[model samples]
Target: MRFTFKCYATKHPEQTVIFTLLLSIFLLAYQLRIYEVPYFRMIGLKDFEQFESAVWLVVITMGTVGFGDIVPVTIFGRMITMVASLWGAFIFTLVLISFGSRFNLSTKQKQAMHQLVSQHKAARLIISAYRLYKLKRSKEGMGSNKSVLSESDKGISSLMRRLKEMAKDFKDERPKRRRVKNSKSQLI
Candidate 1:
């Protein structure tokens, strides 16, 4: 039944979690048995008993907390412990690699997103400043006595051109806008 379940687990990932949990429980039970069982009474640790001890040892080693209370005495048991140690090291290295890769990717993405937002904010500030400057220049041109229209026209034209160029640059780098539609067919 255990072999059948293990085979099924390999093929079905959804079942694998449940199977692994059950298998872990079984291994823990077997580890208790091995710790209690008299060594002189047995010629060899049978298949089930050996498997249970090996799995439990691997779990303990992987967790990096070896309880020295359950040391292997036999040559076969020692060999199993050695293999479990190697497997535990490999599994831990893979976990660290995965975490590092994800952390680097997230940091890079965050930096890029911040740069894009800063660029947009700078463009907005430039446009607002240009608008205020134009308004001030128009008020001065209106009050002056000599050919105020021509001076006002030149100032307004230059301000408009600069604002247009800034708008273009901002549009090029702006994040794509998502349009939300209301039930009344209006876009928000």
Candidate 2:
């Protein structure tokens, strides 16, 4: 377990997250001077007593919220806040990229998934077309029930619409399949 964590920590995502935490803590230590501001002193935040208020300030600053109820007073403290803001944004972006990369399928996996989807779409199109044809033939033979015929017309329209959409999906998939096959053949 420790070994796994060590390897994972070496990756960009984990490093950025850990760096963000460390940086935030460092900034918070630097901003400790801000509690001496008259406003904070009046609120009894001085002397690090019940320091959740300080934590809130650091977190809000890092998040770029800066709610103004609490703020860094000294020049160094303000500078720390600025650094936290930029670092927070940068870390968050890296974390997002990490998540995106984690979920990304390999090219071969994507190709296989697309092929399966294309086959399914083609099968659905064929089934819908067959159903529409059967409905038309039945309607012509059993022309007695007008309500049933009207319902069949609606069913036929719906099936035709579905077939058209599936056909389009199948057609759109052909180019992508060709590209995947070409790439695979080239690799071999």
Q: Which tens-of-lDDT digit does each residue in 129-157 have in candidate 1?
A: 67858776666757655676666666677
Off by over 4 Å in 1: 1-55, 106-111, 114-188
All predictions: root-mean-square deviation over Cα? 12.1, 5.4
Give the best candidate by TM-score: 2
Local distance difference test values of all predictions, in order? 0.56, 0.74
In each prediction, how many residue pairs overlap at the backbone (N, C-alpha, C within less than 3 A)?
Answer: 0, 0
103-176, model 2: which lDDT tens digit per residue? 88767997989889888988888888899899889989976898998898898899888888888888999999
Best by lDDT: 2
lDDT agreement of model 1 with the native: 0.56
Clashing pairs in 1: none
